[model samples]
Target chain A: MPGINTSSLPDIIFMLLFFFMVSTTMREVTVRVKQRMPEATEVQKLEKKSLVSFIYIGEPKNTKLFGTKSRIQLNDVFASVDDIPEFIAKEREARDEADRKFITTSLKVDGNTKMGIVTDVKQELRKSGAFKINYSTRKKVERRSR
Target chain B: MARRAAPEINAGSTADIAFLLLIFFLVTTTMDVDTGITRKLPPPVENPDEDVDVKERNVLKILVNSHDMLMVDGKRSDVRLLKDKTKDFMALHPDNPDYPEITTKFIEELGKEFPASKGVISLKNDRGTSYEMYIKVQNELARAFNEMKDERSVELFGVKYSQLVDENKIKAINKLVPVRISEAEPEDIGGK
Candidate 1:
């Protein structure tokens, strides 16, 4: 039997490797809370990922340690409602002075969570002067007419 | 001694190296694009106790309880009917005194006078209400305004509001059918 050349196999694999490398975005934080977002029909795509700060609200993954109550997460740590202003301030300071106005605070709250926690977070955000807010939600694909 | 070509190094392991890196990236790749409902928060009021008077007839009250029950204008209603109800309430109905009052203003972009509805949707939910119900209500309210805008856009520009690309045309359409949903602070109306 004649041997078929396998030299091009490396080139093809290298091409795929480069494609994956270019497309991949590393997960920024260790999500310590369960985050099943709510679904909505009128969702807008969040532009400029770098300019968006995320606030997660859900039951903690380690329920035994953190208790069953929902908690707020800023970056990788469990945070309280009071920590929100400081977090927003830190996020603004990290960016360029001109880009501060464009920063959007994205709230990723679990659907099962109560509105009280989310409202508290919103009020804190408002007080911090971060008026631009995005309620992170999944897109509802099937549209049902009434 | 005759010059000799260097022996070719074996490239057999190159594929394995590439495969390793590709696997790493594939595992790390999160293809999920972040999407959400964008909203602008009303600036924090210095005097929160102060009240702004809006005509009682001009505001549509929607209340959601902890059990996810909806109340529109003090009448229990289904979520499915919210869009149409809002549309009817906001549509220009000069003969109907129960509906919002219409004010005529000349739009610079359209170069004509248009009667704009002064209707505002006031949504209040209990603190114990689920986030899912809140989003559903928000979605319905947005749909109501969007459908009205689409209708007006079709009438004037022969296109859907979302399909219109011209900035001036969009401005005119927005002026004709503005979205005015005001969410109030959640109260402990429904005991958890």
Candidate 2:
């Protein structure tokens, strides 16, 4: 009889809802680069555990450029074109030896960086003797107004 | 027909469930962030057209290990020598129709070397390389190439800088130079 009592049902329902709501948390995906990226309407989902290489260019800590601390992010530097293939081979070997069946290598470039750097990264990755390479991207999630 | 007036069930309970589901998705899903460098890839084909002839011998291959070390044609060199040595190589391959930028005679001449010698740069960036350094390299190459294109337009075609790049032409310019990057598999490369 006590269990079946219906008078306090509304309070029980409210308490259950509150408990469920407080218990849930959001998940986060951490990418390598720390910068504001340019967004694309179309995004490609990359393979999991694949190879993704990041380049950063900025002033070394405590260095002054033009009398002011010249802060250049990693995206500003250039990778020698000649070194690309060997780099790819090394990457391939490392991935294969680790027992990974499939690998996708990607580059996370800077927005302020010039187009040449992006091109060099791509050129090197392709010629690295690896057959397939993936460029990393993020999907545009619709923002909900608070 | 004695009667059956079925009681009307409340619809409000269903609304409560829907509200809970909406809130759950709102809290659990990740927020999207902005990214740079939109790379439009070649169509995925069941079998791609095999890359023919075009001697791979002259192609200078640079390898970046996961440690970010620079390796050129299997030989190690200081980073400072990269641009100068690339320029020298371009000079050797004169009149190679594939890479027009090679004739520029400047550090920018390296971009021509990439495409002309059927140049293939193989980046073997390690998994641990920071994203910041990766992009910095990419941007530097882009700037170098753009300078080459600008110089070539002025030297070879006598086109003014204004004609080369304009507000209306900027979008098209982005398509002119295609950066070729390939990621090699760990297994095929011997897993070093």
Candidate 3:
């Protein structure tokens, strides 16, 4: 009796592996800040990944780098509110000319972070003309029906 | 004969290699993209007037104290009940003469005063207030306007407001009850 052909199985599996590898965008920046994202209802997905830039705000995971205070992260480097405009301009230039108009700023702030930093970031964003912003949140069923 | 045994490669391990990679991906693959509450930051004003005193009844006050306690118009309130309360105030307050019905219809058809637009949602949070509570309050206000618009859209066009693609219909739908949450300057941490 002939055994089932196993030669093609590897090819199929490899395709799946490559599919995930290509589609999955691993978290580019390791979140140094401890995050407990606030939950909400009106959540909308980012339309295009290419046009979006993320800003991370929270207390540092390693106290040596950020101490106990909330720190902002732009890309891989820890940033400050003053650095936001420069970072946004740099982020805008890195995108395609056609897509530049749609660039969005994503604020991934920690729950424990004070609103002071957040408001400052918003001011910086408004000043920089990076008008579109997303307050990153999670979704869960609401407590009441009404 | 030597020809009886053809030169052949061992293919049995191919499945193992593939399985190993497949499992690797299965374990490592994460849904990394996150969805959130998207909003537009108003362009910075050239010279903003801080002294403009908005009418008390026209402004719906929402404050998050330093202790993370939520207060709607000085009454201790839960975040869960915030949306309903906001809809009542913003969409149409029963007491507001301009909004005889909790309907934006007058604003849309008659071009008359809109209670929603007149009724500003003033949000002031303490510097010591946790970002979590602040975001929760914002979320509730956002939900209020979205739900109100959707309800009006259903009433007018028989479709969800957000689902409408026609520019005219959208303008007509949200003309009055636009999502307007004014972030007042943060209260100093010293004030508590």
Winning candidate number (lDDT):
1
> Which pairs clash (backbone N, Cα, C closer than 3 Å) in model 1?
none
**Candidate ranking (DockQ, best to worst):** 1, 3, 2
Q: What share of the true interface contacts does candidate 1 keep?
A: 0.89
How far residue B59's Cα lies from its native spot in candidate 1, in Å, is 0.4
TM-score of 1: 0.93
lDDT of each: 0.91, 0.44, 0.81
Candidate 3 C-alpha lDDT tens digits along A1-146: 99987778888888988888787666677778877798877888887888899999999999986699999988888988999999999999999989887998989999889888898899899999999999998886766753
Candidates 2 and 3, the one with greater lDDT: 3
Residue-level lDDT of model 2, residues A1-146, one tens digit each, is: 35654545555566655665555443323332334443332344553433443433222333342232222322233335565666556656766576432555445443333333444555455554443444343444645553
* Model 3, residue A107: C-alpha shift (Å): 0.8
Model 2 lDDT per residue over B1-192, tens place = 788989988755654665566567556644433243334333333444565343454455555544556676679864545555444443336665443233222124223322233344344554344343444344334334445455545664466333754543343333333345433332223232
Best by DockQ, which number? Answer: 1
**Candidate with the larger DockQ of 1 and 2:** 1
Quote fnat for model 2. Answer: 0.07
In model 1, which runs have C-alpha deviations exceeding 4 angstroms? Answer: A143-146, B190-192
TM-score of chain B of each: 0.90, 0.47, 0.70
Chain A only: give the TM-score of model 3. Answer: 0.90
Best by TM-score: 1
Across A1-146, the per-residue lDDT of candidate 1 in tens digits comes to: 98999999999999999999988878889999999999988888999888999999999989989998999999999999999999999999999999999999999999999998998999899999999999899998965662
